[model samples]
Target: MSKKKLWQSISIVVATLILSFSAQSEEIYTQNFDDFDDGEIELGDGSIIAGTAASIQGGRLQLTIDGQGLGFSSFSIPPLEGSSQGFKITFDYEMFDSVGANDPADGFSINYGGAAMGELGSAEEGMNGKGVQDNLSFEVDTWRNGDAEQGVNISGYGDGRDLNQLAFTNGIILDDGQRVEGTMEISWYPGKGASFTTTGLNTNADFVDVETGAFTASDDHTFIISARVGGANQDLFIDNLVIETGAGGDSDEDGLPDFWETANDLDPEDATGDNGAEGDPDNDGITNFDEYENRTNPQNEDTDGDGLADGVENGTGDYDGPEATGTDPLVADSDGDTLLDGVENPTLPWDEDNPEKQPGTDPNQFDTDGDGIGDGSEIASGTDPTTEDEADENSYRQNFDGFADGTTDLQDGTVIAGAAAEVVEGRLQLTKDGQGLGFSSFSVPAIPGSSNGFRITFDYELYDGPGANNPADGFSINYGDAQLGELGQAEEGMAGGQAIENISFEVDTWQNFDAEQGVNISGMAGGADLQQLAFNNGPILNDGEKVEGSIEIQWQPDVGASFTTTGMNTNADFT
Candidate 1:
């Protein structure tokens, strides 16, 4: 059964009975997320696809992906009576794996009834804007970060993953770098937990014993405490959760019902969404409730991404069709076309005016051009939406006449990082001259591989650097699932400098111990060991030669990609 659906079977009576059977505390309230019905836990934000659909699998809450599921899933936290003397939260968290091990690697956070966290349409950055004013977050950050909204900065040097650092921010803090592994705990003692000298900074925070590693809570008022976890790759597991209250068994000052916070895992201190009438996160010109009913993100403006506003798609002003009809707001393109849902729907298609124009194909047809290829595929391939001619240049990925059309166009699909690309006449002239060097990448729209296989063709001319028989740096072609912008640099240039999980074919014209005038393939970027594709004893391309070539890579589902090269250095003519 689906993890969220798993909680639907447990009734309120059973819940109460389970609570009654557990260790009843007039002061402490806790939850384990076990033995509960489906509705007891919530995770519509894709927590299921990240790792396992079963949230309680392996007896712990697992937050695995940095892409798919990066939202908060809350469970009930018993209401804390207004007489808050002390509060402490402890959980187990480990950085399962960093995203590409890139600098500023992602992390996760443990928040108490604060803001609704998680990116609606994307994975959320770690520990950012996830906590509320009255909340305290044990931010186990793996990346160097700072939140201006929360007034906390912990920017440090390094790629930032292997470092296990922890910080305390009650919406503010003095970031004490604490490394944790096993069962890490953050507890707020009662001495200075009543009131603070200030409200925003760590100085206003109740003193923390850096030596003893203890915390004090604010005694300002009896606050209701809630709990949630907003994560991406920061796999956290929860077991013993204990929160102590001031007086009665329920929240008194928050004016909320006794079982509300505990039932929904909300903080009584936050009169926001926990009360069912909270704030809108995405600023999409619609209330959070409307977003919820419409199954859109209150935290994202373009939920379905139909080009029209979610509010407009909801049949607002000038819209008088069926309620929530005309154009689907939650689906970017309802017809499975790569085109936005707002295009060619109940209205006319977008204007196909220019060479770069979006196709005006029928919104209902997968292949708007009737070319046997889906409209989405045609669009991704950068072909004209109205053409069905397979031999047309529009159908081809690139035609050297100065432009490489389709989804993998050199100028559109890639950024010139650490390099200069000059298109003179009909040829792409790449240069690494003088003391400077250049590098750029070309993206080809992914194709049907493993069965029909895939073929990519490109022509290149590499110029020699102003070195004595050695050029500045060589050029390379690396392919994998990495982003399209760069070959490897994190902030500048390309993503190729890093080991971005791709096999690289280096066409070197520089003669060095590691580099030579040859074609070498390596899984490692600039690593030692290499497999030769086409080699020359001396600097070959330094003669200002224009070489045409193609790397044909084939793939199978279970099996990986294998490649072959042809037409290296125009050997058919060998001029």
Candidate 2:
């Protein structure tokens, strides 16, 4: 599921107990606005625009003009009563003239309840007409006023004269003029609950639906659509308004109620025709009849509220798998991992129907493979989420066997040579002779949780060349806070200048004296002389022959560090 769907799913629930019955549907109100004169002052419903800044332009209800002064206008439909069955209100609207699309100063809303028509309640203040007692407003707020984020905002004024924001959308912005054109549907089941859905919004491929929990059924309601503008403004217009009240019966006996069909813009009297029970209006594979029976929205492809289409959920879409996900169609997150099923398993052609097949992460388990890192985190870190990495998520190991002639790219770092350094016999040869100064810096990304300390281990081989007793200088492993891919000339086993705070573990091959020989760990705190942290002299070489050994260095902040050598031809183990 997308971030938007994840947020909205918290409050939405499948309405399974909604009582369905048989009754004739009534279209109480509808206005296309095309019948009115281009610049008519009077609306067809015996109502006039209550605010002077708004008017009917080009046969459309122009709520606010672009770049115009503060605008607030409202008009009401004929009064209607609350029904025990249900009601649906739908309308298409657009905010254009791009000037203030991002933050349009203000926006509009649809208010329903006992509030009087033409009151223009808090419209002047960019509110849903404050003091509109016993009314609920479904508002589309463009401006971010105070603490409330912009988008679909549902607020209500109770009998106590108190106003409260009831619900809203999160991480969704519907302010762009190019894609803000949308259609809204308000479906209310009186005392049961209500759902507010918007389509063609900018951020989501599926409709954004917000469900309002149960509320007391109002006895009578006066519906009003209003808009406003403050210092900034955009052209806002409303068209194709529809409102239906009362219950609907299965007119054609196709398992779909008449009121449901009408509300979804389907033909109620036809069973086998277009928009009928057999028709897949949304093309989600599941027919209208299945949608009605399953309690999913017929006009929405993703009725389960995510990127997964309903057809895919029903095991009949683009997904490829040996077994199909039999997840409950009404459930959003099947595994309770705070991630939707579709989001956790986005890959196709799975060997199993398990939602966790893609990226080797299990949708059934948040931390697949029992790794401390979450599956999402592992996937993001370029690690196998389904497997427990021996080096953990941020750690990686690579042997430069190939790429002898080119750069070797590995997880967490890249092996790049500098001058004398080259890949020889599947190994990085930093220097071939005693005077051959070379350096190869592998850019290792700092692993997370490093404050707890980290360890580095590597294998090395050194031998006395022909006629040479031993290699003169030696190599060192350096770690420092410096630029990426930065290195200093290789000499005395140091790779960076003294100006950088660098720590080095140097192995001296040609010892000059007791103090200048053996193995030494030193550091430079930048702008200071090198300071020895530790030293140890051990049998790390074989006389006139090849010597092989492995070294391990572990460091922790404040607690200092330790160095250990293994498999060395020494009388005693070196630490």
Candidate 3:
């Protein structure tokens, strides 16, 4: 043959061999229990298989049967050895008809000796084993009524008999002998000899091989799949049989097998899942095991193990006395204040606004008074902390009567009335009354206009005299004329004529009660005297009639002028 043709044939043969080996590495077998398929001696068709009828639906196989008297089925396969290294078995089944029957003894078994068997029977009876060599069987039983004896055999069955009952108690069996579906998955790890079984049919129960954790399978052995009829006429159906070998068995591929990983509470697939080992579990710059072993918070790094973290302590350099700044390891509050250890001292400028600052440290910190200025400043200025400063004291004046004297009588002969004193809102309110009356005076500080003079307000009441006409009169304001104050006039005697009154005017020295007729009394403006006077001209009777009043004299002290008043009274209630 030509060299080129020979090389081509060789390349083709090598490629074919590679493909064949790759295909052989992974193998799968499946059987659908259709009538056309066999179900008899070698799983042939048209034969009443001993066990239940297994069917396939929704990508899974199902076995259903009645646990009447007893039911059994068997199958055979080639010898299995290294192929058991990584293998998986999966199927789905359910029993729906278990009423009036002996506690639904339906189950499927995988035997590794030489055969596999599935059994359904009364809770008291189960399938007889069929192998004798080193064998392992996985059985999912529904009832536990069977005797717990081992290695016992019944007639018409094979070997390796053990009266171990099934583990599942509930299932769904169709009344029409149709198939009931469920899922059963089994995985084996060859190296570890460990196996795991998960079944969607009976979720509560999980079985594991006691000897070799490796899952058992039927190899060159008679694999019997069976079920028992609780009643004589009970029927069963089975379908979708699948057997496979050479599967990578590791579900998570995390180096650890899924079975072992699940048992040890470790994530098989995630290399970093075991945070207790090397990695930081809390992500606080500390390992989980270290955190568990040491009393210190693994997340934090305070040498003294104080509640305050090391980083936080060092960042703020306020170390309390005797406790070294960053080295003594004593986590004491830097300030002498009794706070938690490692708490930064707010006395330092760094944390001035901190709430931990000593109380009353700054009166301005919390202002109880709404005055724009803080209480500290107010106290410093000798001002009332609770009251606002009056805008202008001169605008209004209050008079005190008999305040200095000990007598409380308003009719005493020596009782004197002084000028109007303390005032607010253009009105003066006093707290004393003299014999006749009392008064206090306030000089109006300077203002800009000649027309800006003063107003006098007083509360007056007449008692026991001619109504509005007696010789004894009331109050008046004298402006420019020392005798006539800036505003207001006294009323003729009258009883019960009490009211608050106000009068305003410009002050002129020439405007006097005795001035000449044609002389311009309105033009004199130099430092004129403004006075508020209260007087009575009536005859002094055995018992004199009295008038009680509060007077407010308001004047601007623009020039070198002073004010005085008499016959005024004071009361705490101005209104």
In the order shown, the candidates' Cα RMSDs to the true structure are: 17.1, 22.1, 42.7
TM-score on alpha carbons, each prediction: 0.33, 0.37, 0.30
Task: Please write out the lDDT profile of model 3 over residues 233-256, one tens digit for every residue.
Answer: 233344455555553434555333
TM-score of 1: 0.33
lDDT of 1 by residue, 3-75 (tens): 5446633433454554455433224444444553332234231122122312554445544433333444333
Q: Kindly list the per-residue Cα lDDT of model 2 for residues 284-393, writing each as its tens digit.
A: 77888777656567788776684567766653322343234434345454433334656655343222334333654444555656645455445445566666767565
Looking at model 3, residue 443 earns an lDDT score of: 26
Of candidate 2, the 10-residue stretch with the lowest lDDT total is 11-20
Which is the better candidate, 1 or 2, if ranked by lDDT?
2
Model 2 stretches with alpha carbons more than 4 Å out:
1-27, 81-85, 100-102, 123-129, 145-148, 161-163, 171-179, 203-215, 250-575
RMSD of 2: 22.1
TM-score for model 3?
A: 0.30
Q: List the residue pairs that clash in candidate 2.
A: 121-129, 122-129, 122-130
Evaluate residue 310 in candidate 2 and report its C-alpha lDDT on the 0 to 100 scale. 72
lDDT of each: 0.39, 0.57, 0.34
Q: Rank the candidates by TM-score, best first.
A: 2, 1, 3
